[model samples]
Target: MTEVAGSSNSNNLLLEQFKDICAVDTEIARRFLTESNWNLEAAVHLYFHANDPEAIQNDDNARNEHEIRRRNVANPRNEAPANQNAVVRRSSESQLDTWGAWFRALLALPFRLAYFSLREIFLFIYALFGGNALAITNPREDLQKFLTAIANYPNSERINWFNGTYNEVLNEAKSSVRFLLVYLHNPSHQSTETFLDKVLFNKIFSDFVRDNNIIMWGTDVRTNEGYKVATSLHELTYPCLSLICLRENRMACVLRINGMHEITPVLTALQTALAENQRFLNAILHERAQRELDNRLRREQEQEYQIALEQDRAKLNERRRLESERQDAERLAREEEENLLIKKQHLAEIRERLRAELTNELAVKGGETIRISVRFPSGAKFDKIFGVDDSLEKLFNSVLVHATCPDDFSLVSSYPRVHLQCAPDWYREFSSVEENFGGTKTFRQAGLENSLVVLVRDNDA
Candidate 1:
């Protein structure tokens, strides 16, 4: 049987080798996406967040479509709709209408910007239950026009009456309204006693009404309850925000007018509109916050899943390493056992060759030849040695082939002191050797120490 090798440390060596390979694989996996795009490649990473095989497939298709669209257009933002891109013809009338709409929108920029800013601040402050200055800005031409139109209504007498007893009506405006009313009245009539009377209570009453409406009225008086009281457009230039709401049947406007006075039905209507605006804004913000929270939770879950998967992979790799090492160890152990069996078999063969001489010694002066024997060729020392059995076989074969003359047989050193147990086969082989040499020798004549024997085959023989 062939001897096996590498019994002691091969398992450890194999584990070390596998660790090197796994480290390389991990490093490559980590950088794979970055190498392809030269960027973070977050999309590639996020693809794993779908949490379902089907969603992953659908997301891939969508991403591909987006990529195609982006690549087709030199400037993606400028790409018109598919249908619009095909239509190069248009009637002059249609073109004129389009141009007119564009022009109107362009002209409305200033008003839109002002209104939007006011709307946002109005909503924010209203949410916090505080006053805002957006609606209180310099007079808007749109608001002015609306006020002028309202003043021209047949209800002019009613507006005048409402403005006449401003202090008295302030109490009525607050009673049944669910929201505050903003009063944005013109400041053209500053000298009138009625307007002045209403103007006097502006600050005291600005906080009076909790209804959700802004009612803007006209009167030059700059300080009056429930009224934006001002001496001139320049004096009214100081912006102030107010809240207003109307009572049922729209008979009264509750005012939360702040820092301004001069009452009007128009201001009353504005207050109601502003309150509704604030409610809508609150709804949108709340919805947006909920969506953001949901997104964050989803991201956290995805990250946890990824981390778990990586940990599982690491454990799996570790198990593989352990298994590999175990196999290596088992293999080495089996090899060592096989090599030991072979060595025992070789020793049995040597003992069989020495048996006859050993039996003869028993007859002469001993009971049995029971000793351990070792053999080596001439020029081979016992000390500086390794691989004893295999080297002995090689040296024995070399001497049999090349040393045919006595002069060719070089005797260097031999340890004849080693002992052996001689079986029957040993007696038979030794008998043949003595007969072939035309001589016989006693075991004592061989001269041994510690009952150890070293045999040297005749090179020529």
Candidate 2:
């Protein structure tokens, strides 16, 4: 079941491809390809061959027969039996039509002759007045070809015509800031030749057209381009003239003159239209200029706003940078204070250990030891035995190392209140210590032995 369904889908896709290639209806393509045993090449070959003349003729004959049968079935009246009387009626009607055609032609002969005579007279008058008859008859030619033919005609150089498309002429008029005169000609019209010869070709009118900054675009109504313009502008007469100008960025017809008119009135109408539309064009230019100025001001304001925003951002970044530096400085100061406190605590522990060891050594040498009582800033007291041989500098170093505020202190004898300078190098020599405290006096003489009270005071006090 699956295989069968898949094959069916593949065949459908192939049929669509064949339809696209041949540009034929899907059903017909499928039927023909199926008849060719699903062979694409054979189906295409048969399809083209079937379009041969004899095959097409046979197909047409078959279709006609089928249409006849269908009509007979649809209308019972068409299916009626044919008779000899009906055949005779059809033959008589054919003969009557043949006679009626001949009689109508004969009756119209005089009117036809009069029409041709009038046309010939018109042509003769046109030639006498230096107009070209051939040019009038071939009005459907291209604009350039038509204009060139007119220029080659007898005395056609008297009229100065602008040679360009309608749009091209309008653009030129806009660039020069002038008005455009568009003339649509219908050469087939009876009055066309007379109007051209008498008004357009006159010396005064031609010179006026040439001297003015106005552009003139001419077209024949019979040409495709001319017909389109005429229909769009709703022109209803031959030899129509329009004065067009650019106003508010669009082409506007200021005035239109239809049918025959004298040269003086046409020129007056053109001049009036130009004057009115020129004011409108000036107003448009003024409005455009004001709008441009407003746009420039708006752009400048936006640029200033952008600059202000950038400056504010820069100031904020600088403020943040200063704040970060202050925080780092505070953090470094705190770290240094903590490290100094830890160093002082470590020195006190080492001093306590050294004091205990020196006291034990002096106690073991009983007679050779000297005992001293020391008081701390916290009012704590301890007794230590020191060898008389121990330098005074060792005693001062131990006191300083144990002091909480070691950098700001002095030691004094409580009774005399004498300040002591414990210089490390000088007091480390036994002879210096002996000279300052023991040389002039023995242990009992200077009252310096045994135990003594000492006070620690702040250096500032």
Candidate 3:
């Protein structure tokens, strides 16, 4: 009975494996596997070949016949009368399907047993050398499935089981300088069930592992990771436990439990292992904490230095901007001053040339002399002799070229204070000095007699 049960289990295992490889539904895998007389190799080859044109034609023909039969059953008018040959053919096909099912049931067990035995032999030979005979394609998939199973187990959620590859969990524990407790579980072992029920699934043990910060990573011995762990630790006993700690830069095993034991012995061993390694773990943790603190301080100092450097740069940039503005203002002031000086020099040259021309103009010969005394608003008086032929314009020019003359002024008789410009010229009304005596060429023509006094009033003043 036990042998039969084992064979049945192995056959189910093979069926699941076949389903995974072909990525097909259970019914479809069973159909093909049964048609191949439960020969996995023949079933797989036929599955691949089933996609060909001839096989597809056959499948389509089968579906068409099934559809026709369904339609004839639904519509009585489409039903055809059965013949003896058709009945015989249908009975033959039915018998063949039944025989195929019986063939699978009978043959699958022995095939699965033979295959399992051979695989185990190879696995044992390879495991003896600390290596896996079969490589797992998706290691993480297996790990995730194992984690899910443990999490769903009764009272197993409280236990800390690292959900990663064995090496990953080991590296993490070593990096954190924590004590690593590894368990290699054997699902087929009789005592494994007891160990899980009483020891690993207990709340007290869970709390103990958590409070001590112990990392527990476990795997099934039948899995790729567990087999590797079993080989590396050189321990094959079911429900094995190995306690490891970082010592001299390596994860060295300090304690190991070879077989399933009661909760007390496991707990006592764990407590003893943690006690022995407490001092070493503390020293490593203290050194790591000190290093982290130093790094944090260095980072803070670097941040402050960067801030100070930025402030200095901003100040330098502001100084440069202010200096640039100051230089611009100074340059503009210098240019304005130079331009003003040049304009004044040019005006002085023009005035000097006008004075020399007026001097020669006033010295006209062989004409009646007219003495004109000019009185400025500043109480300054000047008597200038001029010929009758010397135009009134010449008289005005003599005052204009004087050093003390105003830029704009009008002339009038001092006695009556009557100005000759009663109605100012249209264009030159704003410039009285330049147009005071327009159209009157000589003093007599202007109705001015000799010894006349003219008052020069400064318009701007």
TM-score, one value per model:
0.26, 0.38, 0.53
- What C-alpha lDDT values do all the predictions have? 0.36, 0.58, 0.65
Candidate 3 C-alpha lDDT tens digits along 192-212 = 677788878888888888998
Angstrom error at residue 222, model 3: 1.5
* Candidate 2: stretches off by over 4 Å: 1-223, 236-238, 246-251, 258-264, 331-461
Q: Per model, how many backbone clashes are there?
A: 79, 0, 0
**1 or 2, which is superior by lDDT?**
2
lDDT of 3 at 451: 74
Superposed on all Cα atoms, model 1 deviates from the true structure by an RMSD in Å of: 37.6
Q: Is candidate 1 or candidate 3 better by lDDT?
A: 3
Report the Cα lDDT for candidate 3.
Answer: 0.65
Best by lDDT: 3
lDDT digits (tens) for residues 206-234 of candidate 1: 33332323233443222232234332111
